[model samples]
Target: MLEKDRFFEKVIDRIDHLDRNGLKNLIENLQQKQRVLQLVFEALDEGIIITAEDRVVTMNNVARIILGYKSRQYGNFQEMDKYIANWGLWNILKFLHGEEDIRKEFTIHQQQEPKYYLVEKRTIEDNLVLYKLVDQTEKKKLQFQLKNIESVAALNTLASGIAHEIKNPLTAIDLHTQLIQRAVQKNLVCLDESILQYIKTISHETKRLNQILNDFLLAARPRQLKLSFEDINSFVQELLLLVKPELEEKNIALREEYQNIPKNFIDKDYLKQAILNLIKNAMDAMEKSSLKILTVRTWYDNGRDSTAIEIADTGCGISPDQIQKIFEPYYTTKEYGTGLGLTITYKIIKEHQGEIQIQSKPGEGTSFTVYIPIHKGHKLLDRPL
Candidate 1:
């Protein structure tokens, strides 16, 4: 037998000879150890699930949350029938029932966003099977965003050059057309009414093309941020005040929920432009809706060391397909939209090393959240701007 087995046996043999005090001390020691083990189990970040040889199932709170199990514990696999049926874990549990170890990742759509988990199943002592799960959602999102930023940078570089080439000709046409119109008005030239109509058409088309090019340049070009420390809540409040008249004119109900937030290094002009574009889009979306409500919320997450602004509107919500393409250059659903508003907003956030998150449902509502890092004086003292 092992040393631990011999020690246990010796203790068991001496148990009867021990007095009441000795027994009480031994019980207290065991209880303390049991409590410590429970604390460690609950404190773990990974989800833990253990199944005994007799088919009894034990799980921690994290495991229960990951599996969407509402109960405390399960006596057997049969006790998990309800969750197994709904969670699509029937096959996974079945495979886990076997002797071999299995490892895989699962992507579960939970309400607004999809969550990713890396699950590993292996056997422990006494025929106890253990399943460990680690959340991988944030890791996946960061990887995807990095990849997207690279691709967008490449595309914008190419598009910027083309837009620059086209702008010169458009500007020339616009200016010369204006000169001709001036000459005709001054009676220095004679033209038919049909020719005048053609001139008007050319001028209108030229100006429209010029506006599109301007928007494209704004969206694609790199900008240097004029960083300054400002209170996020106050910044949002001032912006709401600027738009309050329009909101009142359109009978749109406005709500502001501002929590205490830390000041951060930001470009006031760029950030304001980004938020204004989102607010304008929200108002446009609600113009046809019977119930119009716009909500602006600002908060700070100390754990993330970031501050956030969320703009939610009760209007025509975006479809899943449109949400994916909403930030793409020149992709717009509005008839008169230049399609570069969100793109510029995205670019501004990216320039600040920030991120934007959006959630929407068809016929429901949409929320756009912009997150920027919280900066402190000491942290930025040695760090480069």
Candidate 2:
């Protein structure tokens, strides 16, 4: 027990021999403590009820709210149970009527979405049961999300199989287009300029389809990673240089913050692709905004034992609904977007055992933060896997 609590107990034990003022002071002190506890109890979001010998001793304000408790002058459990029969809380009433301390789950689905709670009955003292309510709606939603992820994984496997079957026909089409292009170049077959343009369009479309198929295969399957310890700052710098002209043309201000960090074991090419996708997304989001600022930041967190890259933009931010669907395959808001960008990026990060985080406000801006472990336990030697 705490020193103050022990001292209080000693005083209470010696109460019979105390003077009148001493007893009065002890009573006032206890009342003050009770008042503080009551204030705290009422402020809590969880429902708490303390009942003794099947009689309602006391319940918190939250308990009253959850139970739809209207002030009925109830001195016993029977009266409260009758009042709550229509509140869709008969399970709680049933649990209270039992002898042994047991647990009960209260679920009400007649509302818009399901609300779940666990009303645990614990015996703090003889015939004194404490029922605590814990909300589990978010937990249920998270379980559904996990199931959806599994479904997505299954779909990816199926897509990979289908993409493989399509490869032979696509290769044949590409080869035939190359032959036709060669014949046109040599003037072996006379064709109108308009027909030549049509041929070019076919060849271009064939190449585009081939590229899309490659992306699908890559995103579904793990690549043979050439893991090496490389400086990520210079890597990001090179990418920024590659996109410099586009940034200049768009009149978007660029800000780079590269913190001194240790080299991480990574597939430079794959990681570059991931970060580039994020940068391009940031650029697209800022296309309609007048004040365009693209910020790229790199730092290391000793606590997490990870390195972080943050790309932020002053542009139209993603809504909550859009953010949820962003990583799903073929989901995008851009007019001409293929939507495989984020899916591939997500796959690459997963291959490295890293994670991506996103933060955004509707109109303000958005930030994408990627965390990669600074050191990995397994260094699968530098070779094609």
- Measured by lDDT, the strongest candidate is 1
Encode model 1's per-residue lDDT on 91-151: one tens digit a residue.
4665567647878898777568887888788888768889897878899999999999999
TM-score of each: 0.59, 0.66
- Per-residue lDDT tens digits of candidate 2, residues 208-283? 8888888788778878777877787887898899888999999999999999988888888888989989989989
Prediction 2 global C-alpha lDDT: 0.83
Q: Which 10 successive residues of model 2 have the least lDDT summed?
A: 376-385
Task: List runs of model 2 lying over 4 Å from the truth.
Answer: 1-66, 70-86, 91-108, 115-140, 248-259, 291-305, 319-325, 355-365, 377-385
Give per-residue lDDT, candidate 2, residue 319: 96
Clashing pairs in 1: none
